[model samples]
Target: MTMKKLERFALIAMAALGAAACASVPTYVSLDPSLPRAQLTFHKGYEGTGLFSSAVQNYALGADEYCDSAKHAALFKNVSGTESALRVTPDVRTVVWAFTTYLNSTIGAGGVLGRYDDCRNAVIFTPARNRNYDIRQASTNGDAQCSLVITDAATGAAVRNVEVRASPDCIPRTKAARGSNR
Candidate 1:
């Protein structure tokens, strides 16, 4: 590679790292019982684990990037893991998207690329306080299609008043505008 290309790559990588640092949100830890909360489980299916696929090892819940600058401090994002269940305050909208693809990259000179042949599913919903919700992401049709399911973790019952969607869309939350400079 040329020196110019290397410098450009470094700059892009640094910018991405900086952005990631700025977007960081503390992981959910329900230490206080007094706080209104709900437990959630995140699951991700890896259809293509090799190159060309996204580097997203886990999906996140909550607005890690913040809904608006006005609610900057209110950001909450927890990545998927089996280490433990995550806690979420009721009434907060959550979005999760999983990339499932059968179009994995091949090795060698004859290797080709998959053009928009990937599969994915996204969901958005609000949890009830003190409830246990399970959010599962799945893929089918040779990983060409994706699916999402949110339900009670214990009873296996479908959650009420919640929408399970094939694509994600945040049901915009309202927060009063903060003070502005005079």
Candidate 2:
């Protein structure tokens, strides 16, 4: 082979090696078994109890397509506000993981892989009929249970039934600054 051709091949090989080296799957903590499992439903739009809105859902589906060969997982956290309604705070990093996992698996891998990507929506809880407080609060001493449901992005259907239990333990809170005056 010509000198120039050999150098070109070496460059290509280096680039491929670099790209492969940078390709890595992020790690996720195993779901907590002690937390109560909540049921999450994926809807076509923002009309119902689905975690993500239609636009977010579309993006998740796109991610699923783009990362079809990578493993992924999803994470959900709850944020507190003065309002009495139940609120869902979603972590985008977890959504990316879900997409990666779903994409890496073959079709119909079940909800286990797909549901990991459905962290786009926050499930809000409202008081039950004739109740004065949030249903979550009423049901469990103000502690709400969060659940994750995985589904196929292409068909908008469930892929598996791996139940993720949500408990107060999973919620992260901001710590007070040290050495600050009260």
Candidate 3:
């Protein structure tokens, strides 16, 4: 091989090795297992509010409730806030992933040259919310099943339906009961 080609190959190999060596083991933060509790909190915020009413109507008609303006507004607000918090929380796996992504994007070659290594880590560590499957189950069992309607507070239009679920338990089972039916 030509000297130039050999030099380029060496540089590429060195870069790959450096990245691997520098890459820290991604941490993960389990979602709040109390899905019921989280759903309750989410539901309470939607009650008596017209912001989600239209969205509820859409869901009833087999349409996408996310299209409702009121529901979208509420979702955007809540999700944005939650995402912001996740970015800053210390010792949190989600935060670490976010930080790593940010570094890769801004510090590295815009995260295009290298795959997004932290994407999965961030998702795994993200906190639980009413939108999650487990949280949805809790909401289905909670009062949300009965009071899922929401309306636009300003326009008095049915915006969407907010289903609140129950909180989840994060405790790990003991090894002795790991395989026991009872």
Candidate 4:
């Protein structure tokens, strides 16, 4: 490739990397009192509040990327969120993924390349029961914060609480019990 073309390519690649570094990552924390299995239904998106509500648009949930054993059931309609469900196994422990989007601007040389900034914030949480869940975002010192709330489907009492923070990275947890009813 010509030197000029190569230089431009290098610059674009660097810009992409920079954007990814700022993307949000989701973390999964396993709650105690393990059950054989459970169903998980959650909504992912900005809660339509705060200063950057509009800024934080088009949030996507990548289940397969973070949820090792997560199976996409269906998508429910939310005023400003995407809903999904996953059937989890006892072997899985932590579910991890990132919430990311591109930044766009109309004022400058980057206008043609309007969408330039990569925005991703890390979110981590655990499952408490097989029921409906609500996830919302909070603005903490300009950075978007994530919160998860799970409630019992029958009684409407809170079951598991989701928190956003940095934690030791983990992969899918699986176990094989050997012993027989034979």
Candidate of highest lDDT: 1
Candidate lDDT values, in order: 0.48, 0.25, 0.23, 0.38
> Residue by residue across 78-135, what tens digits does model 2's lDDT show?
2112222111222211221111111111123342121222222222131122212111
Worst 10 residues of 3 by lDDT: 54-63
**Is 1 or 4 the stronger prediction by TM-score?**
1
Candidate 4 lDDT by residue in tens digits, 27-112: 33333436554555554543332211123322223333333333222222122346554444433333433333333323344332
lDDT by residue for model 1 (1-182), tens: 44455444444443453346336434434436677887776654444433332223234555422223111111111223332356667777765544432322333455443332444455567777778877665553234455667778878997766555633432333453323311
Model with the higher lDDT, candidate 1 or 2: 1
lDDT (Cα) of model 2: 0.25
Top-down TM-score ranking? 1, 4, 2, 3
What lDDT would candidate 4 get against the real structure? 0.38
User: Candidate 1 or 3, higher lDDT?
Assistant: 1
Residue 11 CA error for candidate 1 (Å)? 21
Off by over 4 Å in 4: 1-36, 47-81, 90-92, 107-182
For candidate 1, the lDDT comes to: 0.48
True lDDT of residue 136, candidate 3: 10
Residue 51, candidate 1: alpha-carbon lDDT: 33
Name every residue pair that clashes in candidate 1: none
Candidate 1 regions with alpha-carbon error over 4 angstroms: 1-33, 47-57, 63-84, 91-93, 97-103, 111-117, 140-142, 164-182
